[model samples]
Target: MPITLTIPDGLLSPTAQAEAFAALTEAVLEVSGLNGNAFMTSNVVGSINVLPREHVLVAGKPAQAAFVELKLPEIALATPEAKRTFIEKATDVVERAAGGRLQRDHIWSNIVYAPDGAWGIAGRSYDNGDLISAITGSAA
Candidate 1:
């Protein structure tokens, strides 16, 4: 029951991305009732995508978009109800981070549970260095 949350491109700035990352982490803790340290200790991974040439017009103005995709273990999906619960909770976190400018439609997500633990990590690394810098707060 691994869930992946994909953020839209250019939706967040560097500072905003950092804040969103922290906010998302907090949201997960609140919804899952998991300890912060323990949750951080887990192998949760995230990637951010920035489309420099990508912009959307809102109120006749151009705005940048950013995409963030997160992958978590399927252990959260023990039952159908659990899967629904996770999706609902996870999407809530994402929506909050997006500040109403983004929604489920703006992003794409996938949840897969496999006994052999096959979630393509390398395949999902399409964000280049922008997202990595946002996640790590280092120079890209």
Candidate 2:
């Protein structure tokens, strides 16, 4: 899975930005019941894009904002409750990182699911079964 955290420059201090990204990662793993899973931990990768303030927009106008997007296989965060929990936790991570510089409403989050057999790693495509086996360290 990959989590992309896009934010306006200066929305968070450098240290806070790093911490928030780590926190967001932890939130997703924990909510998905994969916390402490070495395979999942290593696979949970992401990027933090800090763009110019003018590039970040809301209502078509430049604004202070953050976007957290998680791209994963359909098998992850499959439950409604898990989705809700992640959204909530992700929002909190950004809010806390802002240190009163940003608002919850200004932070947005979304999850995009890759179709079965489409998710890939190391140049090889992985279906849902392949992912499960890899995550569990067992044969599919």
Candidate 3:
């Protein structure tokens, strides 16, 4: 799993940007119920891109909007309810990190899933069962 956050530069103070990233990561793990899983935690990683304001768009026009995107295999965050929770929590994280600089409407979050077996890490491919096994420590 990978969580990517994109925020327009200057939308949040420099320090807030860092906090926002951490919060976003936590939100994903928390929603997926994998906070204490070492392998899951280590492999679920991504980046925060603070781009120039002109680089971000809302409805095809430039705006001070933030985007949170999570990419995972179909089996991860597989339920509608799970994805909804992650979105809500992620949106909240963006709001708090913005310190009111941005409103709820300015934040957009999405979860996208690759087909089973499309996800891999460190040169090893993993199918749905492989991923679940790795996550549960039930297989090597």
Candidate 4:
């Protein structure tokens, strides 16, 4: 199944967006047992949001806040093990990116596993469905 991973705002620095994407691509490849070539071809999409004048009560005073959000299409891997492994690695990358600079409580995410038929195709005829089935099973 393709697993969609959603990363909430404030989990990473806007400047580090590229780095974060690279990290995710690397992590997914590592867990999926795929080479750098395969990882590079994977369809990866991301977005960032900046809230202006967001206020929060701090020590009985209002404070401004900012954050970023990321979304990854549930990439199909070679197996279920690979899927789980990728998720673990991805989570680690997210946590490391967040570090202690952002409030952990503000971080939000969701993983949605869908059937292979539901997986979207992107790029020039490059789809991970076959690879994902090889690892996760036909249902994926």
The digit string of per-residue lDDT tens for model 4 on 29-69 reads 46544444433334444444433323433354543222222
TM-score of 4: 0.50
Please report, in order, the local distance difference test score of every candidate based on alpha carbons. 0.46, 0.92, 0.87, 0.46
lDDT score for candidate 3 against the true structure: 0.87
- Using all chains and alpha carbons, the TM-scores for the candidates as numbered come to 0.50, 0.96, 0.93, 0.50
Residues 1-140, candidate 1, lDDT per residue (tens digit)? Answer: 12233344655557766665665555444444453444232435454444444344334554433333335444433466654655565566566666777756544334554332443343543232433333344221
Compose the digit string of candidate 2's lDDT tens values, residues 75-139. 99989999999999999999999999887899999999999999978899999998888888832
lDDT of 1 at 13: 55
Residue clash pairs of candidate 2: none
Worst 10 contiguous positions by lDDT, candidate 1: 131-140
Model 4, position 18, has a per-residue lDDT of: 54
Compute the lDDT of residue 128 as modeled in candidate 4: 54
